[model samples]
Target: MSIVRYLTHPQVQIDPDVPVPQWGLSPIGRARTEALAQASWLARTTQVISSGERKAIETAEIIAIRLGIMIEIREAMHENDRSATGFLKPAEFEQVADQFFAEPHLSVRGWERAIDAQARIVREAEAVLARNRPGDILFVGHGGVGTLLFCHTAGCPIDRVHDQPAGGGNLFAFARDGRQVVHGWRRMEEVAA
Candidate 1:
């Protein structure tokens, strides 16, 4: 089967003083990247692509290093732009995050319109799929936007995806045969150690 795996880097860091995109994964997050690299699936991944973000780059690098391959960075693959809001202390962002998910069609507290971000993610993702013929492909990205892309590709409404499951920090698999076919999805926690 032509499989594409979408993986969000494990708990990267957020720089409260800086923008989210610029931040790299924390030490623990780095370990998680390494762990992900050890998965049997890594051997089957012919190519790895990632968001230009440091965390995604780091995560992709881990797999690349193990496989003796290189990571391709794509700006379109980046997490939805969160430049408008600086770092949100956990307590603060949490309260408003629900509202964003609750109203997928609206912007989350003016951060980025959920609908617009999802559209861009879908566009870029389709572009990636176009490049590869039918092998295992890995894309390292973020949680929220990743979910949206997966939802859209699966023909599921973006807003309702949240109700189905929490998809961030996970590996989501899809098959393409002139159409999107969801293979499987698993949160990091659910992955067998």
Candidate 2:
């Protein structure tokens, strides 16, 4: 069975002035991705699919370059649209995120509704899986939509409790054939361990 892994980008250079999707990976994020490129588990990943967001593209590029593969960018795979609020402080974002998850059907402050985000992510994943290619597949994206995909694959409710850790750079794997979750979230570095 092929393994399909979804990895969230690590820390990003968060700039309120820049559009969230345009934010690039911070130094820490680059270093983490560089290290992740060395993971033996990634050896089988023949396809690298990434969210169109800059941070995610940067993260995917590092691994794809090392694996000698080109990345396929999916714009619709972006994080839940928080463009309505533009940017929010950490505390504010967290609070809003909580509400976003708690009320899946209701949009929070113009942000995309949790239910809608889940549907989008699930659609994206299923579309790629339908290709039915050989070897493992790697999906590089943001934590928000990554969590949405994870929850769906795990057969769990859409909730923030299944979210990645605070600093991001986490991953979850599922079997491509069955869409069966092999594991929940784990640090990127721990993928091969």
Candidate 3:
């Protein structure tokens, strides 16, 4: 059966001055993505989908290039919107993210509610899957929404407990036919294994 993998971009440049979505991947992130691009398992990836955000685009571009495929950008697959507060310090961002997941129904600090994000990501994934394309699919995007998607696919409630690890470059896989999760939050480098 074909599979779908959602990969969160790795470490970013982390500029507080830049809008979060505009921040590109850091050197480490790029290197890790390049390495993942060569994974044998990705040989079957016919469609590479990504969020419009810069970092995610960068990540998708690397793999799509290696797979000899063009990427399809889905803006609705973007991370839980946090533009309301702009950039926050690492500690502060963590606290707010915690609350964001903890209270899925409530919008924390003007951010998009977790429930809303979950629905949007799920809807976007379903739209693509409805096409019933051949070969595996790769979705390059953010950790927050990736986690939200994972939770939904795994039949779990919205919670940060399922969040990807820090520094990103994590991935999870699910069966496209039944939308059932095959794995959860493996580091990108280890996906081939």
Q: Model 3, range 80-142, lDDT digits (tens) per residue?
A: 999999999889989999999999999998999999999999999889999999999999999
**Model 1 ranges off by over 4 Å:** 160-168, 178-184, 189-193
Question: What lDDT tens digits, residue by residue, belong to model 2 across residues 1-193?
Answer: 8999999999999999999999999999999999989999899999999999999999999999999999999999999999999999999999999999899999999999999999998999889999999999999998989999998999899899999988999999999987899989999887763
Ranking by lDDT: 2, 3, 1
**Model 2 Cα displacement at 29 (Å)?**
0.5
TM-score of 2: 0.98
TM-score-best of 1 and 2: 2
**Cα lDDT for residue 63, candidate 1:** 88
Candidate 1, 1-193: lDDT as tens digits: 6777788887766667767888888888887777777877667778788988888898889889998888888887777665666677877776666666667677775767778778887887788788865567888887877878777777877664443244246877777555565554686555542
Which candidate, 1 or 2, has the higher lDDT? Answer: 2
Candidate with maximal lDDT: 2
Q: Which of candidates 2 and 3 is the stronger one according to lDDT?
A: 2
Task: Indicate the worst ten consecutive residues by lDDT in candidate 1.
Answer: 160-169
